[model samples]
Target: MTQPPPPPPPNQPPPGYGYPQGGPNPYAQQPPYGSPAYGYPQQPQPAYPPPGPPQPPTPKGKLNAQAVIIVSAVAAIALIIGGGVWYSSTKDGRADAKSGDKNSTAGTTGGTGDSGGTGGGSGADKAPANTASKVLFQLPQPAIGADGNSATVDGSWLTDTVYAKSGFAEIVGYDPVKGTKLWTVPLPGPVCEASRHTTADHRTAIVYEPAMPTKDKPSHGCSQVAAIDLDAGKELWTRTVKSGDQAITLNNVTVSANTVAVGSTNGGAAFDISGKVLWAPKPTDTCYDAGYGGGEKLVAVRKCGAYGSRQLKIQTIDPVSGKVLSEYAMAKGIESASIVSTNPLVVAADVNYSAGDGSGISDFFSIDNKTGQLRTKISAPGDKYAAKCEGITKIEYCTKVVVGNDRLYLPTESHDGTGEYSKTNEIVAFDLATGKLDGQRADAGDGYTISPLTMDDGNVIAYKSPPYDKGGQVVSIDGGSFAQTKLMENPATKAVREVEFDMQPESAELIYADGRLYMSQVFADKPSTPGASDYLAIAYGTS
Candidate 1:
C-alpha cells in the first residue's frame, strides 16, 4: 500500500544489468543470450554490475599499458645501480695496473725506492774496508857546511859544496835510491864559493861567487850563473856578471819553459832559454826577491829609497818585451817583501818599521793584474806576532806565503820564543776568490817549524824542524780541511868534529813525477877524507 512499493525502487534492474532493457539486448545481439558466447559456454549474470563502464572490454591475451610502464621503470632502476658498480670496479683496476708498472721501472733504474719498488741497493751504500798503501823515502841527514849556507834539495839531485884537499869546493849529486854518487862537477876556480842550486822544469841552476884574490892579485869580485844538466852532471852554460866591490847575492832564480829569471842584490833580470839576455842589467834600489808570474809577466820587489827609509816599490814587468805593467808604492817604512803568483791577481806584503824602535809592522796588499788597481789592503797583527821577510836566512821568512790551486796558505811562527829555535809553526788557508779563511787554522807544533811550504794538487808539503834536531820532517797537509800527517823524518848528527857528516835539511821540495815522490837532500858534512860538500838523495812513496 505504500504507493506501490515506491515504484519498484525507481525502475531499477535486478542485481546486475548491461544496457537498457529494451535496447535490443546488447549481448543478445552479440552471443544469443549468452549461449556459448564467443567460445560456446553458457554464463550466469554477475552478482553486481561489472565495475564502472565495463572497463572498455579489454583485448584477449594482451598486456595492459599501465603494467608495461611499471615493469619498464623497475628494469631501468636495476640497470643504473649495476652500471655504477661496474664503472667503480674498472677504475680501481686501472689504477692498480699503473702502480705495478711504476714499481717495475723504478727497480730497473736504481732509485732509492720508498714506493713501488725494493729499497735495498743504492750509491749511498758504504764501501768495503781495505788498507791504503803508501811509500816513504827517508834521508838520515840533509844540510851542508857549519853555517848551513847554500843548501837545497830540488828533486832527485842533491847539490852542495864539499871541501876538497886543496881547500876548494865541488858540487856533487848522489842517487837517492842506491846511495851511490851520480856525478861530480868541480867548481869554476879553487876560490869559487857555492851559494844555492835550484831546479825548475827538470833543469838545475848553480849560483856561486868567485873567490877573493889576495895582495898578490886583484879580486875579480863577480858572480856567476850556470845552468847545469841534472842527469849528466855537466854545466850547460855559464855567464859571469860583475858584483860591485861588495858581494852581490841572488835570490829566487826560476827557470820556466822559455825564460830564466833571477833576483840580485841591486835588481832583477830575465834571460831566454838559450842564455841570451832578455833584459840587461837594470839598476834598482833594492831588488831582493823576484819570480815569474803566469804568462809573460815578471814580479819584483825593489827598495825605492835608502835603508831605514819608509818607501818601497813593487814592480810587475813584461818579461818578453821589457815593459813595466804596473808599479805599486807600498807603505813608507817597508823592511821586507814577498810576492805570490796567483791568476788574475798578485799578493805582496810589506814589513813596516816603527818610528823609534824599528819594530816590525806588516801590511798585506792584493793587486789585480788585469786592472792595475789595488784591490784590498789588510793590516797584519802588531810587531810581536806579525809576519816579515827577515831576509832569506830562515826559509820560513822567505816562503811563508804560498799560493796554489786558487787558494792562499799563510804560515805564522809563534813569538813567545819558548820552543826549539824559539819558533812555533801555524798554518792558515784562505779562499782566493772571496778573501775569507776556509777553515780553522792548523797548529803544526810548538818547536817544529816548516820552510819552503808549498802545495801540490791541494796537498801541502813542507819541511818541518823536529824537536831537539836540526834535521827536517816532511809533512803532508790536506788543503780542504787543514788535516796534517808526518810523512817522514830526517835526524841530525851529534858529533861536532866529524868531517863528512850528515847535516840538517835546510830546504825541501816534493816532485810528483811518474807516480813517485822524488826528494833530494843537501847536507853539510866534513868527510874524514876531506873532499867536497856532501849531498844525499832521498826518494819515498806517494799516491
Candidate 2:
C-alpha cells in the first residue's frame, strides 16, 4: 500500500526511530501515528497499526486498503450510492482467484500472502502498449466516529471476477471493471490483520475482534482468526485460542498451505484451513513466537531473552505440525526484523535502531530456509534505499522492495531531479544469493518517483507517482533488459490529482490488474478539520 505523493517537503522530520534518535515519545502509543518518526514527504513506509507488546516494537503505521496509490477524478467525486462507487447490487459477487497459474503478473496475487507479489504471465499482466487511462470509480470514506479512530480495512484481494476489499465491519466484493459492489460478508467486528497470501483455491485468512469496540472496551482484543473464500465471498470457518484464560491478542496472521497461523506477544498458534486448532501458545519464560511470514512457505520470527536484551530467531516451520524445520539467529543488538520473502528467506532489520531516516531498515539478510544458515548480508543504508519494513513484530510487512528471479529489487530514495527543486528515484536490484548489487537499474525519469508494486513473471510492475501537476502511472520493468513498458496512466486533472496525491503512495493500498488500478486505505480516519474531504478508495482504468 505505498508511494508517489510528492515526497514530504524535505524540511520535515525523517523516518521515526525508537530509543536513540529523537525516539518514540514516551507518551506515544509505543509509536503514535504521524509521529515525528517517518520524516515528512514520506516514502515507502514501515508496517502499520502494529499490535501486541511494545518493547523492541517501535514501528510506524500508514493504512493502505490493499491496493496501490493512483488518484483520479475524485474531487468531482460526487457520492452516488446507486450508480457510483457504492452499489447495492450483489449480483455476480463471487470471483475466481487465479490459482495454479505459472506466470506472474503485475496484478495477480498468488504466492505472497496479502503482502507477497505474484507474476501474471497472461495477457492481463503484459506491459501497456500505450499511455491510456481513466477514472473507473471512487469510494467515499465512512463518516468518522467521535473517537476519531481510523477504522481498519486491512484486506484486499483481486480474483478473476471479483475485487474483494475489507470495509468497516464487512468484506465487500466488487466488479473490477465497473467498480460496482457485488457482494458483502458482514463481520462481528472490524478486521485486525489480513494475510497477504491467497491459496491456489482462493482461500485466505484474517484476524479480527469478536465484537465491535466500545468506550468501556475500546478494543475487544484482536483475537478472532478466520478463513475467507475470496472467490465465494464467505467465511469458511472461525476460531480462537487462549493461553490460560485470556484470549491471545494476535498481532498478525498468515496462510501457509492448509494452515492459518497467528502470532503476538502472548505467543503463537495455528489452525488448519478448515479452522481446526493445530497448536496453541506454549508460554515459556525465555521465548515466544512473535509473528509469521506466509506464502511459498511458513516462517516464524521467534523472540527470546528478557526485555532489554531480547534476541530474534528466524525459523522455517512446518505449517501443519507447527514444528521448526530450521532456524537462524540474528546478531545481538538487532531490535526488530521483518521478512521480505519466505521461500528465498530474506529478512530486514534496523540494527540497533540505526535507521534514522524512518525507512525502518538498515540491512538485508539472505538465508537458507532448509539449513537455517546465513547466506549473505547486504548493508542498505536508510538514506539510500526507499525499501521499508514494519520492522517490529509483523514479520512479513515490507514495501518498496521486490524480490524475484534470484534478485532483490529496491527503489532508491529520491534525490535532486534534473529540473529545479523536483525530486526523482530509481529501482535497483541485487543478487539475493550473494547479497551484491546487480547494477541493473530502472530510472523513474525526472519528477516521477517509482515504487515496486507486484511482479509480472520475471518482470516487475511498478507505480510512478507523478510530479504535483501530473497524474500517476503503472509500468512494467523487464527483468532482463531493465526496460520499462508503460501499462496505464491516470488523468492529471487538478480535482483528481489533488485528492489522490494527498493519499500518498506510501500510505495507500494499491492493486493493479490488466488496465485497471485500485488504490485504497487499510483504515479510514476522521477529518482533522470540519468539512475536510475523506475518501475510502479510488479506481482507474486504461482501455
Best by TM-score: 2
Q: Please write out the lDDT profile of model 2 over residues 190-227, one tens digit for every residue.
A: 67677877666677777776776666665666667777
TM-score of 2: 0.79
Location of the lowest summed lDDT over 10 successive residues in candidate 1: 70-79
Clashes of each: 23, 40
Error of 1 at 83 (Å): 99
lDDT of 1 at 28: 20
lDDT of model 1, residue 5? 24
The lowest-lDDT stretch of 10 consecutive residues in candidate 2 is 73-82
Name the best candidate (by lDDT).
2
Show where candidate 2 strays beyond 4 Å: 1-124, 144-149, 528-533
Instruction: Find the number of clashing residue pairs for candidate 1.
Output: 23
Off by over 4 Å in 1: 1-168, 189-201, 212-222, 242-252, 282-297, 308-311, 342-350, 354-361, 382-397, 414-425, 432-436, 445-452, 463-475, 485-543
What would you estimate as the lDDT of candidate 2? 0.65
- State the displacement of the C-alpha of residue 382, model 1, in Å, after optimal TM-score superposition: 7.2
